[model samples]
Target: MKTKVNEISIKYQGNFKISQAPKISSSVNAAELLYNTWNKDQIGLQETFKVVLLNNANKVKGIFEVSTGGITGTLVDLRILFAVILKSLSCSVILAHYVK
Candidate 1:
């Protein structure tokens, strides 16, 4: 006789709210949006990978920091990014990275 093994499960906490304000119509708009969220003083100190989730209306559904690291670059776990996208039910995504 053998015991059963538990399957892997994914869970999302907190809130995933969809916003209608300030839709991303172009690359400039997207850049402005991301720039506003980044910290000015820390932008040149390290690297941070981020993912912006967009709904069908091109509105921002969510922003997730995929990873952070030293001055050069950061390691991103694709699984986490995909999980966030799946949980947010986003139709599109913008991947951005800040480097020193």
Candidate 2:
């Protein structure tokens, strides 16, 4: 006889309303939005790699920071980045690099 293995469970939790989704219409708008998000944390002293996940309609879904490194640069793991995007059900992404 063989024992059964437990299955993993996954869930996405958020209270965001679709009607309130913020849209990115221009590069300047994207940059400004990302700047505001990054500024909330102590991320200005180093280089950081972030992904702004978007929906099929190009509305904001979420922002995820992939990595942080020294003053000059940072590295990002594509696997982790894709995992987050997939988990969030995001249809698009904007790559942002921050340097201080």
**Tens-digit lDDT track for model 2 on 4-100?**
9975433445788866878988999899899888855667678989998889988987788899898777889998888788778888899998786
The local distance difference test score of each candidate is: 0.83, 0.83
Per-prediction TM-score: 0.79, 0.78
After superposition on all CA atoms, what RMSD does each candidate show versus the true structure?
3.6, 3.0
Tens-digit lDDT string for candidate 1 (10-94): 4434464545356899999999999998888888898999998888899876678889898877899999888888877889999
The deviation in Å at residue 94 for candidate 1 is 0.4
Error of 1 at 55 (Å): 0.3
After superposition, candidate 2 runs with Cα above 4 Å error: 1-14, 40-43
Give model 2's clash tally: 0
**Which structure among the candidates has the greatest TM-score?**
1
